[model samples]
Target: MRAIDITAPGGPEVLEWREVPDPRPEQGEVVIEVTAAGVNRADVHQRRGFYDPPPGAPPYPGLEVSGVVAEVGDGVEGFRPGDEVCALLAGGGYAERVAVPWQQLMPVPDGVSPVRAAALPEVACTVWSNVFMLARLRRGETLLVHGGASGIGTFAVQLAKALGSRVVTTVGSAEKARRLTELGADEVVNYREEDFADRLSADVILDIIGAKYLAQNIRALNTGGRMVTIGLQGGAKAELDLGALLTKRASIHGTTLRARPVDEKGAIVRSVVDNVWPLVSAGALRPVVYAEVPMAEAAEAHRMLDSGEHIGKILLVR
Candidate 1:
């Protein structure tokens, strides 16, 4: 089998595809002959040596993949050889084959191809966990998403809208704002020209930019608002105004999907399958693929993502 290895990580160039030992399913796990892998910003961070795979996880960077089951380990049921599935992985998705816990595997929704399915797991679980489960974004409430054109942001926008939330989102360009509106955003803020916090008050905010938007995010929240920060693209350190939070009765939650315990990640994956998959199957939600590159060209995929030139996900296909 061939897999990507970060050889003294520094940039996308550090990702090297080379022959590696094939993985076998462990108890409760299944081996997948991967067909496609989703490229994520976390992969970029890992390639740069800023993030490390959790203990006992594969060193490769991919976090989600769609593939055909090759083998199932003891104690695993409901899946077997030849089952087409996608999985939310802790790491090691950037390969021809990966071994994953059965709990993380999901049947590809009807009408979605394995290539597109690769883009769903990470974004779906991330959005479902942060915006819906953790933040409890209720129908009719105002929800704002930063980086609206991103994989997570796009998924969040559609899911929140389909669930009856009035969605608002911020993007870097007018073109992206237009696309976001078409995707069901009630309001779109061009962050390059307009401040998102100035014209919007949200009951729930899904923010990717951290420190740079912290104060503004708090100010933009309505009373009793819940703000979940999932990415720190704008740096990690920031001062919080306790007075403002107290007055608004608001709370901020910082979370990451990668380092969580397998059981916890499995729970989120289950929620996505049970709740979100229907929306996807019904076309209320869709996998937005910006590009599909060959698995061996993952470095170029990373460059495309880092350039921020593409909207939605960039998949690496076998």
Candidate 2:
């Protein structure tokens, strides 16, 4: 098998496709023959040596993949060779095959192509766990999502709307704002032109930009609001205003999907299968794919993600 190997801590050019040892399933794990892999900002971070894979995880950059089962380990039931599935991976999706815990696997939803299914797992698990489960976004509440045109952002916007929330999103361009509005966002703020904190208030905020938006995010939250920060695109360090949080009775949460215990990721995957899959099957939610680059050219895919111009996910197809 061959996988994308990071030659050094640097840019996308460092990602090299090279022959690697074939992975075999461990206890409760399954090996997948990859069809497609989702490209994420985290992959770029990993390539730059900013975020390393968790202990014992593969030293590859991908985090989600859609593939067919090739082998199952002992104790793995419900899946076998030839079964098509998508999985949330801790690492190693940028390969021809990857071994993953069976618990992290999900059957491709009806009507979705296996290639497109690759776009679902990471974004779905991230959004569902943070916005719905952790932040407790409720119907009729306003949910603000930063980086609205991103894979997670696009999914978050549609899912929140489907679940009956009013969606507000911040994007870098008017074109992105228009696209998100058509995707069901009730309000779209162009962050380049206006300040979102002064224009709107939200009961729940799904933020990707960390330090750059911290103070403003607090100010934008409605009383008793909950804000979940999942990415640090802006920076990691920021000064928090406890006084403002106390005055509004607001709460802030920071989370990451990778590096979590397998069982915890399994739980989130199950919840997504139960709560989010139906919406997808019914067409209320959809995977927004911006481009499909060849797996061997993962460096090109990484460049696409870095451009920040893509409206959704960029997939590396086998």
lDDT of 1 at 272: 91
Residue-wise lDDT of candidate 2 within 192-264, one digit each (tens)? 8999998979999999999999999999999999999999989999999999999999999999999999999
TM-score of 1: 0.99
Q: Write the per-residue lDDT of candidate 1 for residues 50-163, one digit (tens) a residue.
A: 899998889898999999999999999799999999999999999999999998999999889989999999999999999989999999999999999999988899999899
TM-score of each: 0.99, 0.99
Model 1, C-alpha of 67: deviation from truth (Å): 0.6
In model 1, which regions exceed 4 Å deviation?
none
- Model 2 TM-score? 0.99
**Steric clash pairs (candidate 1):** none
Candidate 2: C-alpha lDDT? 0.96
Q: What's every prediction's RMSD, in angstroms?
A: 0.8, 0.6
The 10-residue segment with the lowest total lDDT in model 2 = 300-309
